[model samples]
Target: MAVQIKICGIREDRALEAVIEAKADFGGFIFHQSSPRNLTISEASRLTALAEDRIQRVGLMVNPNDDFLCELAAHASLDAVQLQGSESPERVGQIRELLGVRAWKAIAVASREDILRAEAYADTADFILFDAKTPPGALPGGMGLRFDWNLLKGLDVGLPWGLAGGLNADNVAEAIRLTRTPLVDVCSGTEAAPGIKDVDKIAAFCKAAREA
Candidate 1:
């Protein structure tokens, strides 16, 4: 199967164009206020509309309440939601029920035990996203830090899963080669600066993912 690619933190027209041109499987929109890449629902709606039927549109939120998720669905045309914070498995189920969209839980991996902990989400989340753990005072994700790819070798996961954290065109092939992740997510790794996505990086990253 071709490796699915989720190009995250995308907020501009050129980035969206690159995502489509590179044949990415998913185009992500951030809704977390704390993140530089965050987009208001109205802003996301416009971009999400561009991705309609072309690629799966994913909305990213961090520890959001029900009302926030409700607003997201009401404003944005999304196919999936990525709960990239400390949300529980039950909450993922609740969000899926609330939005009628596929729900993905972001599991922060710093150790094997963290991977073991993510199993609890398998029953609720439509997919599990393995992202690098953030620093104590840092935002939830998009820090550009990478975990040990070897830590994922032979991981059971017990659910459909994807790899994230510190992935760029240069190292994405190594990541996919090592973990064989069916899907891969990238954000800062494809950026010219925080919140600024580089079209060339986006193109190269997608090219590497598909070739890998």
Candidate 2:
């Protein structure tokens, strides 16, 4: 089976079109205020409306409050919510129950131990996103930083998980081969500049992911 592709941090219509044209499975909207790729709920709603049924719309957030999450779900028509903060397993469960959307819990991975820790959220989350571990004073995720893929070797978490961070056309195939991840998430990797997505790069990343 072909690996699912999620082109993340999409801000422009052209980038959205590129993902659609490439037949990507998921589109991500960053709702965190800190990130350069951050999108207001209204903005994400407009973009999500355009992609209605064409792809799954994923809303990315840090440890958001209830009101923020409610507003996001109401406005964006999100198919899934990715919690990329220091949210605990119970909080993930609460988000799942109250939000009524699939939960994609993101865990930063630096080693096999990190991957093992992800299992704790597997029961509550619909999917687990493995992002590169960031040092202090860095962005939450999608910093285009890569981790050791060999660290994931022989790992078997029962839930569906995605490989993310520093994934692009050139190295996506290798990442896929190394981890055999069911889904791949690309953000800065497909961008021409920081938070500026390149249409061609998006297309290329999607194609490579599918072919892998």
Q: In candidate 2, what residue range of length 10 has the lowest lDDT sum?
A: 69-78
Stretches of candidate 2 exceeding 4 Å from the true structure: none
Off by over 4 Å in 1: none
In terms of lDDT, the best-performing candidate is 1
**TM-scores, one per candidate:** 0.98, 0.97
Give the per-residue Cα lDDT of candidate 1 at 91: 84
| lDDT (Cα, 0-100) at 183 in candidate 1 | 94
**Candidate 2 to truth, TM:** 0.97
| Candidate 1 lDDT, 117-137, residue by residue in tens | 888987889898999998887
